[model samples]
Target: MNISPNGINIDEALEALAACTVWYPDYREAMRIITKCINTTRHRKDPSSAMLIGPTGVGKTRLCRMIEKDLGPTQQARNSECDKKTWPCVYIELPESATIRNLSVVMAQVLGGKPTDNQSVVILEDFIIQRLVTIEAKLVILDDFHHVAEKGLTKTKSSLCNWIIKLLNRSGVAFLISGSSSAEETIDLVEELSDRFPYRAKLQPLPMADKASTSVLLGVLASLEKEMIKLGHLKEYAHLTDPTPYKAIYLATRGNFRRLSDLLHDSFEIALLRGDYTLKISDFAEAAADLAFCCCPNYFLMSHSQLNFALKFQTNKSSETAKK
Candidate 1:
């Protein structure tokens, strides 16, 4: 069994790789939007709300967690008096079958109270509003806001949106909604609801045709490589600067952050299992195959000869860089 020069074995490398965190430009943009929304809504009568719309695996939930962390203690309160505390933000996810009652129950629970099953929707709503006021919650983040539209609950979804709008107006707290593109449809069902969330931040996948997108992709790869080095992986992974592996990776994952991360993770695992100190282009090819990376034309049309050429080119580049 071959171990890394840094004394990290296969199991250790896999664990370290799985725990790596990579931040990108879009994540920063989302954080900015969240902070701006929270600050802008403070002490305002008509608190503004914003929607974060993106496809699945675009880091919407992760962005929300980042914002929550930056704001302050999410599960803790600032002051304690008679068991009441000031919560600056309340984060909750919409139930699978979203309704006013479900929303209220979740809100109340997060606000430090448990509602009984017999509690009416009206009572639950009152309790939620009162708690928000009591805690001075400046922001309310509802993740997976699109769930309201699931299970043929169009009417209920519209009603829930309106109800949330009313809560925003009444509590004067900004609501940051993170959900898929389908969430737009739910919000559109209500005219006033749509107007309330005029500001929308969208997270998009990397596009191969766009120069800026390619730059971002390279930056992400560079950051990941740096993190990998920090994890005691002394071997060079020069995929970021190498054009061959760079293009192949982009084509394989289509610039989706989660997919890209998974591809790199899987490749690292394969290399470790094969007793290789460095990642190879063939490792990436195998990982992409396991991940079903056949959506892009470049990947589908790629031949074995092309892959071999890329592997050889990347190897040569890595060796040249090592000598320098």
Candidate 2:
């Protein structure tokens, strides 16, 4: 939001700019782990596969996308003759009710190959390896790995998982997978496949204690406030770091990055509409009220006891620390 004005467009700035990135410690750690896997992928004797697991709102998908952009930019044409492009990293998000053959075709599509006639699982396996080798791909990320395992772990689903393992090992490329917590059970269905993905990481929600985690949450809020100020949308800081407001925000968002972002986004939109940039507690309440499975009321409307019961106000620790 604090972009330079020179040689820039400002009229549609607010509409074009997205909310401040919710980068945090856990996000960086995940990136480091995956990057290391990519770096040492081909050197390993076995497959260099890792699993990133988390529940919803933990930014699993966002992190994977960031990795793709940072590590694998769009394919650049390598030659002038045919203008062939090399894909270093390939990402595939498992479709709902995914099957082995379906997964194969999607893989081909991501690798810039169409599913040819008479393409069977065994034949597709070789084609996929050949494409990966030709493209010089070092990493292949499969997001939403849980989608295929949504139903009870059936033989077909296990086979699909096995095929992925074989592909990674055969192609000599790292296969980084990400999904919800249920993905662990999906991996366990095929023990050999589970063994292939040895490095597993979890992205958990931020806590609201009176210490480090609280500081991180405050840092994020402060950054958002700074952007608003730079955009001339806010006249002054919202004091989001103050105990009272921060406590309410943490409780409402449950310290989840995406939820926090969503809450701020909703409040920001409402403020722009009301011809003000000041983010109010009522704004947060309304934003949270729109959340799925949420029944919290506006902060101004709910009494102290009612608000406490509704949002559970730092029930993870103590009401005392939350006050700090």
Highest TM-score, which number?
2
Candidate 1 lDDT score at position 42 = 69
| lDDT per residue (tens digit) for residues 190-276 in model 1 | 888887776688998765432544487777777787766555454755455466666777666767878877877877777666653
Clashes of each: 0, 0
Task: Supply the global lDDT for candidate 1.
Answer: 0.72
Tens-place lDDT per residue, model 2, 1-324, is 433323223334344335246567777788888887776666764566788899888888878877777776657675657765677778899888677787788888887777876888788888899988777777788898888767644776677777877897688777888998778778877888888777777898877665645477777777776775565356543567766666667766777877777766666555554554455667666766787633454453455566566456447456778679
> Which candidate leads the pack in lDDT?
1
TM-score of each: 0.79, 0.82
**C-alpha lDDT score of every prediction, in listed order:** 0.72, 0.71
The residue-level lDDT of candidate 1 at 320 comes to 100
